[model samples]
Target: MSAPFQDKVCLITGAGSGIGRATAVKMASLGASLSLCDINYDNLSATAKQCASTPRHLDDVDVGSKQEVEKFIKDTIGKLGGIEFVFNCAGVNPTSIPLEETSDEYWDRLMNANLRGVFNITRGVIPHLKRGASIVNVSSISGIRGSAQQAVYCTTKFGLIGFSKCMALELGPKGIRTNVVAPGYIDTPTNAGIVKGGEAVTRMINGNALGRLGTPEEVADVVAFLFGEESRYMNGAVLEIDGGIKMSSTTSSGK
Candidate 1:
């Protein structure tokens, strides 16, 4: 039998690792042509090699650069015919530093990598996106709630939620869908060392109702749903895949 995404063309940013890599692999498994972009060439090539569908291209793009993002989109379209789906998953988390200690450079870096990166990619890809195409922005639980020492990161993510909603309203008329996936702490190479034998890990597990960190694959599942016809009616929505982390307060506070 043919795969659900057979012949579809997908563009994924930050596809070298974590949720981005997982989503790229998942989409490829369903037969979608992939355009993987990341700053890490090695990881991007690794992901491309693992994909079931051949990659149309792998780009080392710094999404914060509008020119680079536009170039990547153009390259993808040139190679894959057209873009049918886009996953804006590139982002960064600030170190656990007090607000006052956070430097201007830190804040700018976080915003540029997270919020501005998404904006750059979206603007570049919108014109080329086919009708019925889907765009999924990867936000975070920090965006939906307060997180210690993550003020800047949280701010960008919260902005992303709003950005995606407004884009959805504008794109919906064009038969394109825009939405967001807010993931909780997920196990990934970037966080693996930090999460190991750390107080932060303990706090993360205890804070979640499930008492565990989420996996990249788990978040990718939600992304796939958003991309497929199963979620055809879903637009301008922020689906939280945080194992009840956001809902925990309501249960514990019990009004």
Candidate 2:
């Protein structure tokens, strides 16, 4: 049988490490050509090297900047021909600051990196997307339920749901499907910084039905699924990859 993504060009932002990297590797394995970007050159190169067998390109661009994203997407098309799928995974986790102490500077920074970054890239790629193309934006479980000290993060994710919904509605006419993937606590460098060990880690593990953190590969699996023709009928969907953390409150409530 032929590979699922053969001849298709995939664009993934924040392709340096974690779920982004995992997705890059997985997609390439499915015979997709790759165009990846990240602010971290080192990590980006690492992902590229792993997908060396496929036609791949790497760029260091800030997704938050419209100009940068535009140039990057255009470059991808110029080199790879056209974009068929986009994984808007470029975003930063929020700083655990109380709402009272959060400053405008900090909020703007995260917003630029998270919500605006998604908007910038997704909007830039609209004109270039092939019909039947799929767009998957990586959202966090916090986006749905809200997290303590993550007011801004939650806000951005909430905004993404609306944004995806709008994209789905508008672009659905053009055969472009837009969806969001809301992953629970996964073992990624970003999360490692905030919940490495001790009470926080234990608390998170305990809160999940599986009683353990998730892996980037696990989340990538769903992303890959969402991009394939198997999910062709799916649009404007926000699929969660958590370990049933949201399914039952008893896990965390200790009831």
Candidate 3:
């Protein structure tokens, strides 16, 4: 049997670690060529080597910058030939502090990395996508619902969903599909402190229906599906990899 993504060209950002690296690993095993980028050359190079035999190009790219994203896309097109699967997986975690204590720098940093980065990358890639292309933007459960201390992070994610929907509407006629994946409390390096084990952590872990944190590979599986023909009919959709955490969220109307 052939790999699901055999011969496809995939572009992934934030390929240094976490969800991005996991997706790159999975896609590489499935016979996809990759154009991967991240700010950290060491980590990105590590991911590149783990790809085994899959053809790929790696660069230290800051997706937050429009100029870098534009060059990255051009280089990808020149190297990979064309991009069929574009995964906007680069983003930063929000500072878990009250809005009152949040400084302007913190807010701008998150916005630049999360929101503007997505915009820059997506804008750069749109012209390269033709018929039968797929675009997946990574969001968070906080975007779908609310969080106590993640007001701005939620804002960027919510904006991503809207941005994806518009892309779907505008580009659907050209045979391009756009979608967003929302994950909840995935076990990544950034969340090491929370997943380390504690009372509050235990509460959050048990709060979800699964009573545990999710893995990056778990989310990558769904992304692979969306990137392939299995989801040919899916567009402008939001798929959550939260293990039922959002479903269990408290709501006055339903309860």
Candidate maximizing lDDT: 2
| True-structure lDDT of candidate 2 | 0.84
Q: Write the per-residue lDDT of candidate 2 for residues 77-133, one digit (tens) a residue.
A: 999999999999988876677899999999988799888999999889998987889
TM-score per model over all chains? 0.92, 0.94, 0.93
Candidate 1 lDDT, 1-255, residue by residue in tens: 457988889899989988889998889888889999998999888888888446568999999998999889888888888999999998775466779999999998988999999999999998888789999998877678866666777788889999999999999999999999987767776662244447756666676778887888998889999999999999999998867784543111000
Q: Per-residue lDDT for 91 in model 1? A: 78
Model 1 C-alpha RMSD vs. true structure (Å) is 4.0
Candidate 1: stretches off by over 4 Å = 192-196, 246-255
Q: Write the residue-wise lDDT of candidate 3 on 154-206 in tens digits.
A: 78888888889998999889999999888877777765335444764565566
Q: How accurate is candidate 3 locally (lDDT)?
A: 0.82
> Candidate 2 versus the native: TM-score?
0.94
Count of steric clashes across candidates, in order? 0, 0, 0
Off-target runs (Cα >4 Å) in candidate 3 are 192-197, 246-255
Worst 10 residues of 2 by lDDT: 246-255
Error of 3 at 3 (Å): 2.2
Q: How close to the true structure is residue 111 of candidate 2, measured as C-alpha lDDT? A: 92
Whole-model alpha-carbon lDDT for candidate 1: 0.82
Error of 2 at 244 (Å): 0.8
